[model samples]
Target: MSNKNINRLFEALTPTTEQNEKMFQNILAQSQNENTRRRGFAPVKRARSVVLAAVLMVCLTTTAFAAAYTGLDKTFLKFLSPVNNEQAEYLSNGAYMVDKQVANENGSLTIKQVIGDSNLTYILMNFTAPEGTVLNAARYRFGDSMITTDQDYQSIGFKVLDDGNPVDNKISLVMNIMTKNSIAGQTVNFRFKDLQAADPLPGIFETVIPGSWETAFKLDFKEYSNLYQIDQNITMFGYEALLNTISVSPISISLKIQSRSLKEINEAAGRLKEIGQNKYSDNYPITINYKDGSSETTSIFTGLHLLDYLNDQMLTIKTFEHVINDKEIASIVFFDKEIALN
Candidate 1:
């Protein structure tokens, strides 16, 4: 599509201020309802058909974008929002580098790594996983994690692999286990390879449980950091969250680069800028896949800024799909863009 047209598409996807408030309220209500239901109270029942019908009405009212397909026969509604504007310089060597440090009340972790090729534009993250006693065959809910998207996190699973076997040693299997209840019993060992790249980013990486369960099960990182010895924790969440976070992070970084190629970047930037301008309806959505077998569809509004970062660069997005045993599952997409550093 022409850059101008793409820009308009993006603008349409940006949600209005009022819409944002409404969405926030809806989320709060949903959470409260879930809490109530978990307490053995009769849950409030809203008409599913009515809700679906209303979402359909919203979808039909907007012409900018429509749901191409709602997988799993689920009702899908778009919640779109525009991102902030920023600029960054593109490295010619096909690599970009990123390093981040995250701290919580209990402890902290630092991530340093090259994302792109070492000889090209490279990005990297370095972080040490907390070590603790392993809880075997433990299952935890992820609905309470601090994530930004609407996708369900319950579908994601994490396991500790030792010689290809699921192990209960939490400290040693840092890269494979997803959540932990307590760090008191056993230690596990894990390497970076055990962490599949499909693992979600760090922002939404929080322990999952109900308030009571969380209160009873959660352990402070400080309590186990010294006693547990694990090299890496490869935690994976729902496929959608993992893909969305990865795309958003690098795209946000690219926009922060300083460069003189406005004309080239503008081509891509215009598409994003148009979204900011509200040229189209707020229902357009886009799907992203990763190099691993994971895919997610996010509202176009959420990804518009990433387009602006690319501009006129030769970029290709490829999705990798994989299946194990007979189940068709897992996929990831790689975003490849060519830039002239000199």
Candidate 2:
């Protein structure tokens, strides 16, 4: 097949897992039919064996690609989520290295490193199996986990990056923690109850050796972000919004916004709900323009506080998929109005 045809064939194939077996079976049937048409003899068993071998090759190739990332630098480059130059460089320098490991009967878990500001924290962790043992799963899910901080906080959420792919023997995981207050300078306690491998079908799981593990580490949060205070009224989706402030960090950019009236708040809430349902839609709160003449749009809206809806007071934080270099930002565009940063 030509290169373009090969690309199309690969794209046409369903993703690996539960559908993989059925797809291979169809290929085997087709191969048998073609062989019989040409030679008047069907090699059914041979065709079946070849199809199964193809499946094995696909699995092995994926595992090999995952294993190619050896060290911190290479591993960071393999992050499924977008990692900008600033975040990658900081991780490469070992500026926030926390090589803490906790081992249980199941295996060992290590906190490779971390990077965060006040509102968010990103943790890099690795799982290593015992000698003669192997964790050969595409992805894993943690069960009954409790992530707490030393200080009393409003809320905390710990999530393993589902978007990331896993490797055999050594599984690398990224934990994204969202908190009500700054997670910096605070010691965090991580407790996990059970670990399971995601099964062939969605919502099905298989336990990974019965065991639990726990660990704690102190986070060194540094303020390497630029904050611009802006109190202006902007019209979005035909509703008036108050632009409170814009904080530009190396890893992400967040914008704080509010509504001017209760009616506007309710209307904006409904509109945002509609936008959230569509994954491909971009919430046009702010656009970051870099010095290199490139721009990025906000991927999601987070840190929403609507308890004070009566006073038309709410905090809307919009985040970018890739990191934003604070120094390289030229300006921010909102509703066709450009605010020069430099």
Candidate 3:
């Protein structure tokens, strides 16, 4: 997309001062917390063969959490959710790198790693079996001693290797675990109960949950300090849009934007819920450069919500995809100009 078009899309997200500050503080706290952490998961339980989905969390040291997939598939690793180059850096640098491989009769379960800020956590896993072993389905969940507000957290989610593609001996899995209610600083719990696998490919053959494959452990809510910012105000196509805050994460930017209005600001927004989180497909401008020397520009925005308070029409925005290449972003091109942030 043209720089002008991209900026126009990004300039739409505008958040209020309080909202901006809160977002900034939360990010800072997560980044600062990264400095204080130990990397090792204490396994609570072990399930057997083709059925090893549940993994409990335990605390451990960094030396014990090393990468083991050196000989494994790099192509598959890169494709796993949240395990891009930047995320790999995050795992090697600080996040607990769980490299425990539990053996099974027909295959094995490798708990790759787990990384978490105060708000969200991601788990990486790999399931390897005999060439013909058909790993069908799995379900898991995350819990803590303290439960955050229902709205603050999301249910555990997982994505298996190839998803709809055919099965293979070695496959990868990624998860998105959300949390709130002070879950960041505290040890969290997990469970992976049901795991099913079929044999000799899919047909009239019966499916079995395998002998066992459940585990438990605690994840040290290690803090991460990987946030960068680019604060500026610019006039795009005559309208003044303030780039109030640009928060960086392992793979993306946590952005906040705002514009001024004397009235209640988009009254249509007030009738519904949240800020710019509706079907109002408005375009904005943004450019991001990754540490890998790659960059992208897009006017597409998601994870957006419009929050209106008083006369302020603020919009919260984050990148629609894993646009940040470097764990530390190199630059952000805005207003048709190359600008370095962080």
Q: Best-fitting candidate, measured by lDDT?
A: 2
Q: 339 in model 3: Cα distance from truth in Å?
A: 5.5
Estimate, for each residue in 1-342, the C-alpha lDDT of model 1 and write its tens digit.
233433444455555667755755576566567667787544346434444455555545542232221110010001001111111111111221123454443223332222121011111222233345233332322232231112221112232222222343221111112111112222222112222222222223334211211111111111111011212212112111111212122221111222335344344334433443333321223344443456554333421222223432211221111111111212222222211111
lDDT of 1 at 128: 30
For all candidates, what are the clash counts? 60, 0, 47
Candidate 3's residue-wise lDDT over 1-342, tens digit each? 233432332332334456555655555455445434544342324212111221111111211232321212332234423334335444345456567676667556677766554334556777666667655543322222222333433445555554344544565676655432214444443434334433332322232434334454556535443444445675444555566555555433444445564132344323332335323333444677767787776554444444455435454444333324445567876554455765
Candidates 1 and 2 compared: the better one by lDDT is: 2
- lDDT score for residue 12 of model 1: 51
What residue runs in model 3 are displaced by over 4 Å at the alpha carbon? 1-76, 80-90, 98-112, 116-120, 126-133, 136-157, 162-171, 178-184, 190-217, 221-225, 229-242, 258-285, 289-294, 299-323, 327-330, 333-339
Candidate numbers sorted by lDDT from highest down: 2, 3, 1
Question: What is the TM-score (0 to 1) of candidate 3?
Answer: 0.45
Candidate 1: stretches off by over 4 Å = 1-92, 114-317, 321-342
Tally clashing residue pairs in candidate 3. Answer: 47
lDDT of 3 at 120: 49
| Model 2 lDDT tens row, 142-187 | 6566888753333333334322344346676766665544577778
Clashing pairs for model 2 are none
RMSD of each candidate relative to the true structure: 24.5, 15.6, 19.6
Tell me how far the alpha carbon of residue 80 in candidate 3 is from the true structure, in angstroms, after superposition: 5.8
